[model samples]
Target chain A: MNRFLKILFFALLVKPMVLLGLGLNVFFKAKLPKQGPAIVVANHNSHLDTLVLMSLYPLSQIHKIRPVAAADYFLKNKLLAWFSLNIIGIIPMQRKHIRDTSALFAQCHRALDDGDILLLFPEGSRGKPEQLSDLKRGVHHLIKSRKTLKVVPVMMHGLGKALPKGEMIFVPFNCDVVVGDAIPFNADAKCYIDSVSNALNQLLALCMTRQSVVKDDLE
Target chain B: MFNIPIHSFYMMTFVVILLITGSLIRWRLQVKNPQTDYLELKQRIQSWWWMIGILFGILLAPTTVSIIFFALLSFLALKEFFSIMPTRQADRRILLWAYLAIPLQYYWVATNWYGMFLIFIPIYVFLFLPMRAVFIGETKGFIRSLGTIHWAVMLSVLCVSHIAYLLQLPVKNEQAGALGLVLFLIFITQFNDVCQYIWGKTLGKHKIIPKVSPKKTWEGFIGGVITVTLISGFVAPYLTPLTMVQGFVAGTLIAISGFVGDVVISSVKRDLAIKDSGTLIPGHGGLLDRIDSLIYTAPLFFHFLYYLHY
Candidate 1:
């Protein structure tokens, strides 16, 4: 039933709603790994961002991909909790438990161990749509603890315009989910958080420059 | 029973002429310019066939189906227009209302409620959407966001809904009927686009608006308008309630208004920094790209014909 609901909700309703409802055309500039146990990190902008990013994955991965959502927000009510946990397949992290990150750590490991793809916002929370803020330590520790995990930095623009962080109405704006090359974590990798942050910035800058080139060609 | 009317034959004749012109262009290109490629020209003609197919399909379908068809086009075009406009996230739910407006506006047309159809988007949607935005409690960029959303609905859904309404106009011309009015308006406006482009290419020198659309030229604009005005005079006697003079005026009206509509949408694409609205139609950028002129022309013609004849 959960699988059926996931297929119905994300694959059927949510996908078309975001793609057609929001008038978004999703393109993956970077090739995705056919099989993945990679930890995907992105800058959070809107609630639509998770759906937009998830849509980048092919339909076969509807079940394997999980977004790390705030447990308290999505899981506050029983029906929503069931919808989030079972239907959407989101891995909830209790943000209220400021110090105890281990529970989330265990859940992430368990999912990855089962060869499921995981998505996380390294910023810890949604920020101003355009600004990519300083990276939090949670992402660094997560990568460092698991040496074999590959960290893929994805940069999405226009989504901040599509549905801003604090806004409820999603203004239809075209968004791009740019995937970067998977950065494999090794024991002694220095400043991993800063590097991932820089990579995302680079990807975003590259997209902006490419967009200008398209405009120039139009001229 | 959906019987093909005399005006439907005229419409089919115009399409057939377009088909022959395409074949002639292909043949001429093959023989005369062996080294040059006519891919773009070929693609344009190819897209036309698809457009004609969908349009005539709807015209031949039951009235309910035709209404549904235009409503869907409005939905897609509005979706594309709003998708790129700078709307804030908190106001996302407001878009649901905007999308809802498409079917509702079209429903008014389907039921032939002329008074309600005319004012629904202009009045009700205008007032209702802001309330939705305000409910979200976000003040920043509120006016800008609200205006763009409302503007998109008005242009894409509301104005385009007038096209569907034209089909249901109470016309006394038995041979023509409302379908003729719909076809006359669409054919003249859309073909005006093609004529101007061709005329501009052949004898264009002066750029009308270089900054906005570099391709538009004085020669093309005049040539296309005169050509459409003449064609409208010829068709109106059979298809419309207008006399030859009125037909010429309507043609000129459509020509200028069509240009305004084209450039208006061009300005939008320019503002949004997009080349095309969407890629729904092959060779035709998006649905909006093909129908921009008609969006402005549809309602204008509907009102003009409604007052003059209906």
Candidate 2:
């Protein structure tokens, strides 16, 4: 009963607020990722990127998808630390150390093993529009290690332009995420990792190549 | 109850006048900007629908129900405020505390504990939150964490409780005391927003604060204040124990404060690089869009009534 009340409370209180923050993304005529235990890899651009992803999924599925955020950023401040963990359910990963990366991979593997979907941004950090930052070994490792999990390459277009890096002012624009076909996993672990990386690059290329409405109108 | 028949008649007349004038102006403008005609028409329809709902709700709903509705409004508004503001993972515990503060603050207002409501966020919550963080002994981003928590509570909870505090006012009659005041404040503030938007679109050339809020104009501000003041001046005696001049003064204050509230929230949105605080309300951008004017107006209007002994 207590758990139900808590869920109801969140539905009434937090969900409405989040939907408002995300601009009723569910209402938009767009597609979403199909199922769980899937790795959703997209380009990282701004803080709003997480919100965009969260908005795409149903409210009940929010807990099922753990956003892999930088531990340094989310854990850096006390207030943000609480919001990221409790409110948003972000999984923090250390960016710098190799040992930290291994531990983070284990946690990801465990989460996937437990049938939870992982929201991973392969760029590892926020970057410019259409530019794919060097693929962090995290995504490669997670794919190679987990035999059951499918790597769904998602390309988030127009988010970077909407809310640019190091800027807090958002220009009114439409953004869409394209969830491509899942990368097939094989017995050869190294080959599987390479295939996933290539799939992600192709997805990013599709995003970069797609003509934006605003850009076309301007020209 | 005060003369219900007369109040209903007055409200009906007010709504009719606003609807006719707004429709006429919107039709005239539609010819000039054919592309934006549908969007403008939709906005007008939505605003009218909201106005009707609010008017009917005030007339029909009990005081307690109305108060709860307003409290819910404040909750959504505050939630929007925090969503845009950046927070780190370590701050999740503090956000949990922030979300919990909403009900407690409203409860204090419901129980008429003005003394506690006033200082709950600034004094007690402020001291207790940092102490809780200190207990964890993770002092890395302590100062930044504490500041965000403090700011969020101050803006969302402490500031918004002023609307709740309106529910505690003592009037000549029991029913007219608290709930009536809340209704009066809301009516004046929201009407002022509508009038300002209408007037601004019609005759607004002189920008009030072009950089912060381009849509806000001096013409709109004056028009909103005058319209609200006149309406409040006429309605004050029926709702509360205030004279025409006092009602006008209150209306003027509410209008000005509402403007400030709208601008402050807009500035916050600007800082966060967000358009609308959230998109819960259709036609309205977010919770912030609905209550942007209420944030400053509530606190100022509450204090004003408190000092006036009404």
Candidate 3:
């Protein structure tokens, strides 16, 4: 039933959303490496960001990518719990009782341990829409235990405008997902997260500037 | 049911002529200014082909097909509108219900339930939307979010559905049928937009609404309105049920409303700090952008013509 539900949800619901929900061209600034166990990190903005990022991948490999989301938030209700756990197969990390990191760490480890691509948002909480917030160090802890964890910084532009935090209405906006080259985990928690943050900031800035410069010519 | 309006054929001919003229101008510009940016021009022409093609295809096809085609357009436009709207997780189910209104609204047009069609959205959905959002128990941005969804439905589904509803107009004249009226509204609305832009570029020195729409100029607005009004004196005889004087009034109404719609959408994009609504059409920014004028003009022109016919 779980497998059946997953297939049905992905095939019917998530797959059509790219063409229907965003309803615009979604450009990929950089592509992800196929067949890899990379810990993909991006800044969290809207509830739709995870789904938007999920759409960045091919439908066949969509199953391979599992987002590590806050269990308290996503699992707050039965429907959401079912959606997050079964349909998308997101690895739930506790947010409420998060001081006790052992269990959460174990789940994170288990996800990577199983050769699954673990998606992480280092921002920890929703940031200002269309702007990146402070980057947290949760990702460094996740990859510290694993020897061969490849970390990639993925920047999502415009999902925040599409579905901003605290707004229930999803507005149409252009979205671009830019993935940086994988930085080998050097056990330098601060350095690794900072570099990832910097990479995303550059991409976001570049995207904004290019849009105005190139597109405004028509006006 | 009314006969295939011969004016519909005339409307189609006008569209073909406009397309040909646009192509010739494009060719002239490309040949003359080899270094200029024709990307915008090319995109505009490309989008015109698809838009006019789909429009005529549906207009000429069975009435049912046209209704369905427009319903699909409303869906796409609404979907594009929804992407920027921020909805709560709890309200996803409610949002689904909101989307379902698309077909239901179009169904009213297709079935020709005029009273029910008119009230289903404004009275029924308008009341139900807020209550539905409240039932979901998400309070944050409730009014704004609900209003956004409601406005989206009103604009995309309600306003746009007016075009499909034109098929239901009970005009029996085969030579100048009601479909010609539909084509006329679309023809005038889009051409006014283009004519305004061209005149503005060539002669506009004074800005009309600089804050709202930077491109709009007093010179362009007058030029566009007069040009469309003069053209209406020639074309409106067959395309509409109105007299020559009445056609001029309708033309002026449509031209002004076209400017209003363009500025209205401009204000929206300005608020959102975005360039275009969507990249749905190549030259056009988004589906919403293209139909911005139609949203305002369709219902107004519909009622005016209906009153005149009756």
Best by TM-score: 1
Task: Encode model 2's per-residue lDDT on B56-157: one tens digit a residue.
Answer: 566456656655665666566555544455443344456556667777877777788878888888888888888877776767667866886688678767
Worst 10 residues of 2 chain B by lDDT: B1-10
TM-score of 1: 0.78
lDDT of 2 at B128: 85
Instruction: Estimate, for each residue in A91-132, the C-alpha lDDT of model 1 and write its tens digit.
Output: 888787767767657788788889888888888777866668
Residue A104's lDDT in candidate 2: 64
Runs in model 3 lying further than 4 Å from the true structure: A1-14, A21-25, A28-40, A44-188, A198-219, B1-6, B20-37, B85-96, B134-147, B176-178
* Candidate 3 chain B superposition, TM-score: 0.94
* Model 3: per-residue Cα lDDT over A1-219, one tens digit each: 776776676678866765666543543535565655778888787877777777667666777788988887889999989878887889888876768677767877776667778788888877666567788787777777775767777777666655768877764445656677777776687887778888878766434212311121112
Chain B TM-score, model 1, reads 0.95
Candidate 3 DockQ vs. native: 0.14
Deviation (Å) of B225 in candidate 1: 2.0
User: What lDDT tens digits, residue by residue, belong to model 2 across residues A111-181?
Assistant: 77777778888777787553556666567666765666677776665555446677655443234455667
Q: Report, for every candidate in turn, its global Cα lDDT versus the true structure.
A: 0.78, 0.67, 0.76
